[model samples]
Target: YAGTGAQRVPLPTYAFQHEWFWLAPGVRPADATASGLGRVDHPVLTAVARIGDRDEWLLTGRLSIDAQPWTRDHIVFGMVLVPGAALVEMALTAGREAGCPVLDELVIESPLLLDEDATVQVQVTVGAAGEDGRREVAVFTRPERVDDDEPGEATCHGRGWLAPEGEPVTAPPGQWPPAGAEPIDVDELYRRVNKHAHLTDAGFDYGPAFRAVRSAWQVGDDVCTELELPDVAGSAQGFGVHPALLDSALHGGLGMLYRPGSEGGLPFSWSGVRLERTGSTRLRVRVGLADETALRLEISGEDGTPLARVARMDVRPVEQAQLEAARRSGRRSLHQIDWVDVPAGTPTSARVAVLGELSVPGDRYADLAGLEQAVADGAAVPEVVVTAVETAAEAGDPAERARATALSALTLVQRWLDSESLGEARLMVVTRNAVAVRDEAPELAQAPVWGLVHSAQTEHPGRFTLIDYDGGGVPDWGALLDLEEPQVAVREGRLLAPRLGRAVVGEPPTVDTGGAVLVTGGTGGLGALFARHLVERHGVKRLVLVSRRGPAAAGVGELVADLEARGAEVRVAACDVADRHRLTALFESLEGPLSGVVHAA
Candidate 1:
């Protein structure tokens, strides 16, 4: 049953799950299987995400395709994570013998929540070459396949817990607080552990649950906690703790609050979530019981704090009829928006059935256009639509083929589906300038429209046209820039990007490598002293020394290492960037992309 207006706002949703993907470090012909089953010319790799209770999850990946359709061909994908530094390197390697086009430079792109703890570093190197233009792109740390027939071998690696007087227990393989788990100093043990970082990693902290059990007081039906997080850098702004982290924290805490029996935990939704980043030292999170089946949580740090008052969830079985009814309703609801899956730069239009009344100040489009006009009248310039494909077919023209194309180009789609609970929706793109010879040319008008609105509307009122055809939605709307100034979008708006100007083409891409490689402490200190010497003598390209008081810490160490490995000779000294003499020396080192430098005190 639905609630009344008083309880109208449904709780937001989130996911908490563990996922795995196989990682083959290298794929060499010599190492290929002996079986004639087509040498592992190019092995295929797949990643699987496992939902907490459900058996399936969403997947994220990149791999090489094979000629033969049958045998499971997988490529080795891997990534390295830096513990002390916020950096992760993803690599995807192809077979030297794989009959694929040799690439000059492979672009590795991964999206990350702005404030997430882990930062990504990408390395693209030209692997072995063969007759065919085969090139290998390495994506570090390939995800583990959750469904692999082979079970994951557990290994213990963490500090062991030592009793003040009694014998210390070494964590066994597959045990929490592993045998070598970094033991917390006695002084630090009394301080609350920072599980937020772990929980935030990959949106969940399944690993810690194994350890949280160590501090269990009494397991109950649910667990809750109020935590304070440091707002050291004040980066949090306008976002809440990722839902995955919140869910995982709840999962772990509940495991502690309610042990032994695991039940009555069904995620309903989140409500009253308020996130703020105050200029405080630590982030403070408060969780309280809202009711029988709800928990209120508020998070805040020096930068941003959580404002969610409650997390409502349900745990129940679905009746077959109810499930069937839901399926039917879902299909009908989804019918509103026509989905078209196209390459990142496919040009398509959509017909949006504007719901509600269109009054004098009516039409959301008009409002959007008006807003654009206001901006244009001021400082903002009018934006043009960028098309991804050649001129769309003129309506009714025999050449205009409105058939749906497969989404085989995008591997990310399958990856997300394999690891998440969400499913891809199908939609159509309608071309506004389509010339239909017949009055009844398969009414392209669909319930919900998806298309781009050209800023030209400000100059050419009523000239807005929708580009729609049968296919799938373009994974990246940026492809529209490849076409004529034609706006494309869905009537319901795009989930990835909404404003047209936001995706303007022709902007040069620049990676902020945190300026220079940074080390901790001043140049005179440990990291800086090493950096200074390397810069003065080494063939270093650039040197960044960081010091706590001198320079605000910048550039993760893992990133510096990767840049060096990939040919961007870099050195980092943990010293202060504020020191003029030190900073000048680091910057003055004459050179085009420094060759090599050192980072030590």
Candidate 2:
């Protein structure tokens, strides 16, 4: 049968795509076609998306110490940073998606700490294949400052290239514990390694599951070590290699390179890693110099059966300050609302009922109540419902009226619950003249509605969409149907999405809250508290406490008098910032110049 004519075309060069398929059963990755995200099977990565029409792709997921307690144990300088082995695993996982599973090279740039209570978000990006057919991929974590809907600047933890599957590893003829390999005494091994942990941040700072190296032997120029995965997660059941065990494999050989006189020694780079076989817990590892720059590893099952091999791994000394600074960056990370641009897709073609006629053409309804009654009377329900928020400027001078506006929106939320016809409908709360763009004076009076609507959205997710316009052209009303960004801003015909970022603050030559300092929401819970602090702490003699309620708000008179008695000049202005003209007049009436402002409202 073999003699029959058979033409042999080139067999696929990449026999091992290195794709990881062992995942937790029944748990599907997050993928919504409507949002333009595709499915990703990696355990850590939940969603994947190709950027526009390009070949670049982004994969994202979230991890926390609370969920993956193993990460909680890897501490360096008292920082709970994820181990480099886990990051390489992530690189391998992402590389497979880009069609090149062979990890040609990887560099861990920064430490990503996992907060005990908060989740750290991660993103892996794969770029288009280069001329040599290698694709560059990078792993970045959003530190602790992460927003589910709005991703901010991510700190790159690692970056590398995934090449087409290279030559397969060929293990030499060997038996378990090869003859002539001198056994090294390891009685004081872990104790000696951890002895200087308190004095030097470079000590083997690992906890229970991470301490996996069981014994060691010197085989001529190479070191062979035995390791067993700890009892907590005893088997490499669903992983290419148990991450803790994989990490310990690297640790097994570090003693050969890390000298006491060295200032730093931590894994910096890895290359040509291939998972020859999938499941293994007990491992026999051989570590030797592949070249002058790095160490090579041949990992095998306890019986000397090959499991994985690395062409090279380099452990370069990294400064304590660099790692410390990375931790500090996580601690100092802050977030502010940043509007990002988005596409203006077609609005929903389904019937839409507009409550008030400020903007957006839809079926007319006198009010939310009218719409509710029409639905109650068996009228055809709209697929969408919308309303324009009225700012305090439009309502009156009292910014406290903003709370009343929120109450009105609440009525609609409650009426929707009672309407069976509009059960599947969505409510779009659009504000034409409100937003807290950094360093800009927005309609503060209309801000409370945003908070109230946000709470309702939390309680009943997917029922409400918050939209704001920077007071200009009619927004591409289709924005409401865009589930991609439920909360967005419309300005100059472009849609903007809100993202959180670290708040950049600079110091001037002098620090002063001198002269007249204004505090909005100055009568409510925090307003009164802030006024007292300004008077007591900052030694502010002149103070203006402004709230939407102003003088009419209960306890405002008492608060003003109390601050005045505290050796301070207090003026409780009954002016709303939303009332641009009234606010200007109040400033003009001031005895001195306004020095500082706090928009607590």
Whole-model lDDT values for every prediction: 0.29, 0.73
State the lDDT at 335 in candidate 1.
17
Which one is best on TM-score? 2
User: What are the RMSDs of all candidates, in order?
Assistant: 24.7, 23.2
Model 2: which ten-residue window has the lowest total lDDT? 191-200
lDDT of 2: 0.73
Per candidate, the number of residue pairs that clash is 150, 2
**Model 2, C-alpha of 379: deviation from truth (Å):** 71
Report the C-alpha lDDT of model 2 over 1-601, residue by residue, as the tens digit.
4889888788675653333345433233445455778866555676778888897888777777754667766777676778888888777777777787888998988877775655667888899999998999899887445446454457898999988777687574366566688887664455444442222445446787787888887788787889988765434554567778888886655655554565436678889887766667788888877654467888888767677888888877655666766665564434556777777766667788888875676888988779878888888888778887675444654655776676766776687666676778888888755666545566666677777777888988878888887767766675555455668777776777788766554322221656788888888888889788877877778888887778899987788788878988887878788889988888899887787887888
* Clash pairs detected, candidate 2: 347-478, 400-548
> Which candidate tops lDDT?
2
Per-model TM-score on C-alpha atoms: 0.19, 0.49
